[model samples]
Target: MEDLIEDKRQQTGEINLLDIECLGLINPRNTYAITILIYFLENSQDWSVRQEAARILGEIAFGNSEAINALLKVVRTTVHDELAASPDFTPNLESNSQIEFKQLLISSKILHNKPNLDFRASESLYKIDPGNQEAIKALINLSFWHISAWCTHDDAIELLKQIAIGKPEVILKLKKQLQSNNESVRGASAEIIVTVEPNNQEAINILIELLCNGGEILEETQDFFTGKRILEHIFKAIVNLPSPL
Candidate 1:
């Protein structure tokens, strides 16, 4: 059966790859299936093939350490594009060298971008084992990345809240963030708690204290992390809820 699936995968047919995935679902706990799926995930040239392999790996190896680690590997993979690795400073360089030099001189940057696979893997880890500290940590690490235009910042925050649910250590981590001297960190921590546990008294108190002390960002300041709109909503949410006592 493994040989047949491998044959199908080598054919480079989407339908054939999907058939192998169905087999994975049928025998999620099979060692052969896990091995095959991981192979395709790491080595497949086709993005769809790699992506499906990852999706199935998460579902099948949901709580298994090896499976989780494989997913983490997928998420950890990064494609590097050197903006200006070697600056052409020779006088005899081609005409385009000057243009490239101008661009490089302005800013030589190597931007690190995480793939969607990481998002899927992190979510699957939490889904399979919400209490796994490593999974939660991975999700937190993912959150630190700059969200693309296609994805809203709120999406990451919501995902983080999901990680915090039923995880006391995660909740405590957020609470600690709330104590940071940085207002942005405190504001973010409070906002996260509001979503994770809306009725939590500590969350409410933090929101209230932030309102009284730090106040809101001025109209002129366009800071994304320490804005007034989120605090306004949090305050309203706490006000509308009954007392915790």
Candidate 2:
């Protein structure tokens, strides 16, 4: 496995597609494979290879502390890197008219800057530790910025719904996010809370508020499109409610 990874790195500056395909055929539980996978996950320059390694580790090393720690590290490092690259947005009295435009621009920058590695690692962490706080937090934060691109927002909310079941702390956090100043964050949180507790009046109310006041809340044209996407989620959640609002 090491030879294949190294050869691909030396030849193509990345693991070859065929080599990755072949590697996937190997037994995930092989101890030697785990060591090599972890090495590549941390050291490989190729993000796709690192992502695959993280995924395999999650599948094979269910209770392994070393594997869990590695996944956590990936989550932390990727998030940090992405945030550092995000465009800063600051509006002054003179620039008030540009606030909405800048918000849309910043959101676009963040969405494109995020790597798939963090999402993969977060998913792996959840696999190994069902209610891991870091994993849940990572997903929630990703949901807030990603919107509909790559289905990231939907996927994160789905996982959060799974984690929130029988987990009061997770539910509590979702409830708190309902009050987030960011419209996307509030929408994502409300979606999760409503999914978990269909009759959650607070969640339902927030969704309704977003639908009714989205244009006023998000003044820019592009931002309203974002709000429109959130409205789609809101309508879906409302439709799925066991009881009507």
Clashing residue pairs, candidate 1? none
User: TM-score of the candidate numbered 2?
Assistant: 0.73
* Candidate 2 per-residue lDDT over residues 104-154, each given as its tens digit: 666555444344677778988888777788988888887774534546666
**How well does each candidate superpose onto the true structure, as a TM-score?**
0.61, 0.73
Q: Which stretches of candidate 1 lie over 4 Å from their true place?
A: 1-4, 10-17, 44-51, 74-115, 128-130, 143-156, 181-185, 199-202, 205-245
- lDDT (Cα) of model 2: 0.72
Which one is best on TM-score? 2
Please write out the lDDT profile of model 1 over residues 1-245, one tens digit for every residue.
67776676578643365655677678776777777677886666455566677767767776776777777676555432222222432234467966767655533221212344556666666666656666566555444323241242355567887767787788787787766766545655666777767777676776677667534443323555434555554566467656667
Worst 10 contiguous positions by lDDT, candidate 1 = 81-90
Best by lDDT: 2
Superposed Cα deviation of residue 244, candidate 1 (Å):
8.5
